[model samples]
Target chain A: MDAKTFFIYLLVMAGTTYLVRAVPFALVKEKISNPLIKSFLYYIPYAVLTAMTIPAIFTCTGSYISAALGFAAAVILSLLGQGLMTVSMLACLTVFVSELLIR
Target chain B: MHFYKKGLAAGIPIALGYLSVSFTFGIIAVSEGFSWWQAVLISMTCLTSAGQFSGIHTMLIPGAYLDMLLSQFTINIRYSFMSVSLSQKADDRLRGIWRWIFGFFITDEIFAVGVTEDSVSRSYMAGLSTLPYLGWTGGTLLGALFGSILPERIMVALSIAIYGMFVAIVVPELKKNRDVILVVAVAAAASCVMTYVPGLSRLSPGISISIASVVAALVGALIHPVREEAAEDGC
Candidate 1:
């Protein structure tokens, strides 16, 4: 990446992220009373995470089988109420082992 | 207890957890052709996993500036909610322009830990955030600089760590929040459509993800308008 292009794009990424965090913290003191708006914000995290993860996660690894194994492990561990670190590690381990076997 | 000391102690678990995720971020970002500094710069500049990864994915797609702007705003808009809630928890020390500086540090983990306290001071917030921030940035540095030495198998496995993290975050919530399960499914389906559809595939991933997130969240908001009492209960 050209240094300039990379820097400009990063500024865009960092700048928007900062504003989203900073504007509300610095300016908003009262509760957001609008239930509709509140609901939108509330669901934004889950919606965004799911959209980014699906389809993309399937193709992240070298093979679909390994990625599926990892994805399954992640979901099961998470559903079992495991922590982020535990779920991530175990999922990766599943892929690592499965990929080795598949190869 | 000294405020910073107490905060540092409280922050250890979050720091350790960050080490794992950000390490994976480092390896994948570098492997994806980002320079070591570029990856570290991202970790330092944006203390978020989903947003950072989404940013890189958008950039790699060479998405338009408009796409980049909208996608980042959509993915990270959740932070505004967290920061707004934390504003109620902040002490006088986190006042004035310093709120901007302090606000930059409010990741999901930090917000979870910070809100449990009666009131958070600049010192306490600083102490709490310092280690996790450093752990995140430093882990990225290590992963970017040295991650290549690991066997390709391990690296391949590591590639999916961030997505695993996303699943970990969303799955537990989905199990408990029946409404969110449908909302997530809706968003995922929307994303898949954009990916697999012929003409729609030409739309940048940034635009596609943003549109999907917004549409699904809108559906969620419309379906469950978060009654006033429920909204209050959240705060």
Candidate 2:
């Protein structure tokens, strides 16, 4: 895409994303009364984060072995109980460096 | 008074996270043949790691428009989850018009920090989000513009940014539960199971991560169910 087209592309994409993000805030800030819904909402981040990160561990290369090892590295470090920053960095380092050395 | 300081504090982690992740995104975009500007647009507009990744993947494939739309929605539906969570955190005093304004900047990291913030005021969350938002956009622009000129080793090191931030967040939380050995055992075992099972081994990273998180969270909540009786009036 050229400069003009790409700019427009970004504008549209950003606009769409912002709209998706912004609309719920406009519509639902006052209506949430049920405690269960509120409680469920609190857990959404954990679900989303896990969903995004764990699978990446196993499936990045369409291979079970590397992904399993990567997942193991992340889980063990995260469980052995580093902070989020440590866990992520260690996992990435382990995966990237391992791949570099092994492959 | 304290708001500005808190905002800056929150922004620091965000800026760190944004710089690393957006830089990676920039590299991915450029390597895929997109222009520097295109990369910036992706970061600025999408403001999401997975969404952008999925978008790039779709762009490479030969597919129907319906398939593209479905894929984007599936990946991005999570943002709506964040929005729902923030609705509970936002104050009743917040006006209708400004509600969406604050919500617009609610990425996963921002939502995480906001929900855990000492106060859930709109100003606090907005202030917290401002730096990360700017850093993310700016970092993407920088990465795209300078990606070629930079040495490969430097770029490689930059990829560690998000992982570093995640470590920072998880480490303290794990430490605080001070002796909640069960979480450690459960989380580790679950991670292993999620990693090795044959049927699950075929799923996408996004779904796998989601399942793992849900399992972990359930384990967490089960271990310490919400003390609704103890919840404060506003909370």
Question: Per-residue lDDT for B166 in model 2?
Answer: 38
lDDT of each residue in A41-87, candidate 1, tens digit only: 77877888888898999998879999999999999999999988789
The window of 10 residues in a row where model 1 chain B has the poorest summed lDDT is B226-235
Instruction: Point out where model 1 deviates above 4 Å.
Output: B61-63, B227-235
- Candidate 1, residue B124: Cα displacement in angstroms equals 2.8
Tens-place lDDT per residue, model 2, B133-222, is: 888888788777778787654455444444344334444444544322344345445655666789877654434544565565556545
Q: How much is the lDDT of residue A32 in candidate 1?
A: 74
TM-score of chain A of each: 0.94, 0.62
How far out, in Å, is residue A49 in model 1?
0.7
Give all candidates' CA lDDT scores.
0.85, 0.59
In candidate 1, the residue pairs with backbone N, CA or C atoms under 3 Å apart (3 or more residues apart, or in different chains) clash, namely none
DockQ for all models: 0.75, 0.28
